[model samples]
Target: MIQRFILLGEGYTDLYELFEIARTNQRRLLRLVQLDTVISGQKKSSLVVILQPAEPGKLMPLYLSLEGVYPPEEKETERYQLFEQLSHELDAPIHRLEVKPSADFNELELYFQYVIGVLRLNRFIPPLQ
Candidate 1:
């Protein structure tokens, strides 16, 4: 299967949109992931929702809310709480991975590719075909 990352926004208020996507597409939901990385000095999280491919589908979508969440360990953020709620509601386990911050990459696209490679390597997503 071919998987592509679709960026929703940089967390903030747009996080609700990610939740809605999961709620609305509950049946198609395959996995939930929280990508954690330290930017500058503070720890942040990017929440991702992976959905199964739709009709005529070779493309599986990985919806991302880029590094907009405060790591719960340092501070209990409302947004991350909501993500937890989503996990309970969906009966899905939220997978966590430590990754290099997108800022480390020269291009945003390269950063995304790096994440994809990581996800595939961990068997979170299918292998490249």
Candidate 2:
């Protein structure tokens, strides 16, 4: 299966778009993830929505609001609240994990590859075929 991360921009207005996608694609929704990272001594989070592979195409899209939102653990934000509401509505528990910040990578693509590797190792996503 070919799995890829589709970034939806920093969680601001983008959050509503993310919520709508989850609500609309509830049937294909696989898992919700909150990737927590510390960047320059500041805590931030990236919300991700994993979806099952498309039939015939084998393209599995992992939608993400990449490292833009403040960590909901420290403060309550509407974006995080929306994410939580999505979990409740879909009955999908948001899997939370602490990970290396994207700043650690030289390129954004490298950061995505690292996340994909971690996801595969944890069996959250399928291994290469």
- Root-mean-square deviation of each candidate, in angstroms? 1.0, 1.0
Q: Which candidate tops lDDT?
A: 1
Candidate 1, position 119, lDDT:
95
Which stretches of model 1 miss by more than 4 angstroms? none
Which residue pairs overlap in candidate 2's backbone? none
Which residues of candidate 2, in runs, are more than 4 Å off? none
Per-residue lDDT tens digits for candidate 2, residues 30-54, read: 9999999998888999999999976
* Candidate 1 total steric clashes: 0
Q: Assess every candidate by TM-score.
A: 0.96, 0.95
lDDT of 1 by residue, 16-127 (tens): 9999999999999999999999998999999999999987788999999999898799789899999999999999999999999999999999999999999989999988
Q: Which candidate comes out best when scored by TM-score?
A: 1
